[model samples]
Target: MLVQMFDLLATRRDFFVGLLLEHVQISLVSIAIAIVVGGIAGILISEFQRAAKPTLAVVNFLYTIPSISMLGFLIPFSGVGDATAVIALTIYALLPMVRATHTGITNVDPSILEAARGMGGTRMQTLLRVRLPLALPVIMSGIRNMVVMTIALAGIASFIGAGGLGVAIYRGITTNNAAMTMAGSLLIAVLALVVDFVLGFVEKRMGMRSKAAKRTNRRLAVGALVACGVAAACAVVPGMVAGAPATINVATKPMTEQYIMGNMLKDLIEQDTNLKVKVTQGVGSGTSNIEPAMESGDFDLYPEYTGTGWAMVLKKGGTYSEDEFGQLKAGYRKKGLGWVGMYGFGNTYGIAVRSDVAKRYGIKTYSDLAKVTDRLKLGAEADFFERADGYDALCKAYGMRFGSTMQLDIGLKYDALEQGSVDALIIFTTDGKLSHANATVLKDDKGFFPSYECGNVVRTKVLEQHPELRAVLKKLDGTITESDMARMNYQVEEKGEDPEDVAREYLRAKGLLK
Candidate 1:
């Protein structure tokens, strides 16, 4: 395992390096902005005691909101990526920064201020020269806390398609690669500790009694601030900076197969064209997030399902025309999008019963499973329960009456069944777990679930901008089969193989990648 991890590091050195730098850039910028804005607000509140309660209340409330939830809320307005991430991180950093600055300033010696006034120092001079310096230690403590917290919390930024080590973490989690997840988490923790140590050193230096040491500390602090300014500038725009390669943003759902697909698109685009591809894999709500991002021009394209668009995106009814897929394409075109490269796979939904349960109950099909559901429990992800073609509808259609339904995370459903927490669970056709499941997938004899043909949904503008992409993407059409996807997913999820490697191998096998 360690050998594999080392190989992963050696092979993906540049990838990890880029993500680490991005993580640093985001954390630095968020801390810097939070300190400035939060410090100002803190001073204002300290000056006007009446505002303190409400101001702190608001900051505290924002701090309490989950970072993922905050990013989701900000997406419609700020869109996705680092901009949204920085904003959310800054908001969270505000509470510690504001409270610390306020407490430090308010706790300063009253006699000292009176002395400054006696010396004819103006109010501003007294606050800056006397109060601020005296409050430095406490404020530095706050800054340290704020900085570390922001750095740690910054990982969630990847959920909204922002770049960072969070990509590694999210990718690892999705593919069940503990080594990759640990590597990403270890780096984040180390970054936080290192930043905290630097701030602590600066704080200690400021407290030095010697004038020479004070001068040295001032120089060091100024140099650090200058470096921070440069990093912040880079973080503010990331790939949008002048001279950077033209970027195409592709998004992916939070699943193993989608992660692999996102990487495949990135590899293909970069290899075959002058453009750089930035894949934002693991967007929280899949189509819900990526569709809006695509329409708003935030995302250039993403892998999507035909049936999902049929029912959810277009809100079409159960009944459809013979050219239903044609209608699906037309619907997306109306929204300024185009479908390309049907990957020749149908990762549709399925029912998998614990092997023991299936054998004991003679459940070879959906109807057979339904007969015994009265004594068994059903399990599926939360979204599976709420989707248009989801739990309630599936149960109603098949006349299933499970003793109870357990809402599990998509990743945990297999484990839930293995642990006897559920007798049957919803499973994706391409799910890696299916390869090794101690469960039997029941045949959908009723043909209740809609077909979910997989393909790329690209923005019309992006296609026009890079006409060559149309041909490059054609290489993927009619390539991957459902079994092929399931096998690749298993490679990543159970074998701990890197998704990029697995994707590359598949594309290489098909002569699409070299």
Candidate 2:
């Protein structure tokens, strides 16, 4: 397993290295901020004995919040990526740093302090020359613990579109790639261990008694700050190019289909025009994340599902309507977002089951599945369970109460069905795995789902600036059939082809690109 993990990771060495750099970037920023802020808070509280317990209680409360939940809470305000990741990591690292600083200082021998004061030491002098030196070991121990925790929690940052080693892990989980998942997990563990060992060694070597030791400590502190500054710069510099002329930013949701679409757009634009393109794919929350970024002009365009725009973005309710496309266009236009014509596929949501199970249950529609709810175990993705238009709403509409429902990663849903762990799985109509998994998709006899026609959702401002972009995008209209999408996805998911290569090949085969 270990050898296989390394072999899998070696296939994408550059990507894994970038993940490592990003993981270090956020971890360093969080730890640096924690040490300064937590150190100050610790010093302040130590002098005021009455406030120590209450302050520590507050810091501990932050420690109790789950890492992913904390990242989610900051998404709306920070809008994902490094800002949210760094802030959450900093808060998580605080409890240990603060407690350690306070414990180290307060534990100093009273007799030693009295002797220092009697020897003409002032309050500040006693703290700097005597107390801090004695407390260095304890304080460094807390810092070491915080660094390790931050490194581990940084993996969760990828859930919020923050790039890190965690993104690789989540992608592996979603794609049902055990070797990839193991590789990511092993890298994170290795990173944590390396950080712990280095910090531990430094802690042992530090002794403020000697002038040379004090100079070495100062040099180390300066080096750490420089590294933190470099990380911060690397994170912020990308946002600077958001509105650069003749450059476009494309984004995609976290799914196989979306990834293909994003890559397709990137390839088409770069080849057809003089404009440079950058793609940010596998973003969390689908439209929720992409739409906001588009509105803020952070991203120029992305492939979006019409039904998602109608229901989630437009906030309209009730049954699907004939005028839904018109309504969707108008709704997005109001928000300064333009919707291009559909890209020749309508990938709606449906309940799927293994072919043998479907035959045994006689389930051809959602209503038919409801009849066997008491015997069926349902499986769905994490977002499907949480979204308003997801599992709960689907159940209410179909009157379904399954024997059990397992929350799963989208990538693992097919595997779960093949293994018979789930009787039915929620799936997209165009998923390539449908054929591979030998799953039969049930029809929505009651018209519970709206049309999910895929299209390019772009910022009006971008279209206005590069008017030819609209025409370039329109060239993609009705180009890819449902089968084409499914086959393309299969190539990437099952055959291990890079999404960009799959998309590029599709364009070249269609004579759509040079």
TM-score of model 1 (CA atoms): 0.93
CA displacement after TM-score superposition, residue 359 of candidate 2 (Å)? 3.6
Per-residue CA lDDT of candidate 1, range 1-514, in tens? 6766667777888988888998988888788899999999999998899999999999999888987788889999988888999999999999999999999999999999999999999989988999999998889999998898889999988888888889888777777776777778878998899988988877787789798997888798799889877876766687667887788988998899998999999989899999998788787777777888899999998999998888778988683333689889999999999999899998888999999998898999999988888999999876677777888888898898889999875666787899999999899999988978899988999888888989999999999989999987888899999999999988888887878899999999988887
C-alpha displacement of 462 in model 1, angstroms?
A: 1.1
List lDDT for all candidates, in order.
0.87, 0.84
TM-scores of the candidates are 0.93, 0.91
Candidate 2 deviates by what RMSD? 2.8
Please report the candidate that would top lDDT against the real structure. 1
Which window of ten consecutive residues has the lowest lDDT sum in model 2?
Answer: 171-180
Give the candidate number with the greatest TM-score. Answer: 1
lDDT by residue (204-247, candidate 2, tens digit) is: 65754588887888898899889878867877787686674477
| Clashes within 3 Å, all models in order | 0, 1
| Candidate 2 TM-score, true structure as reference | 0.91
Which clashing pairs does model 2 show?
174-411
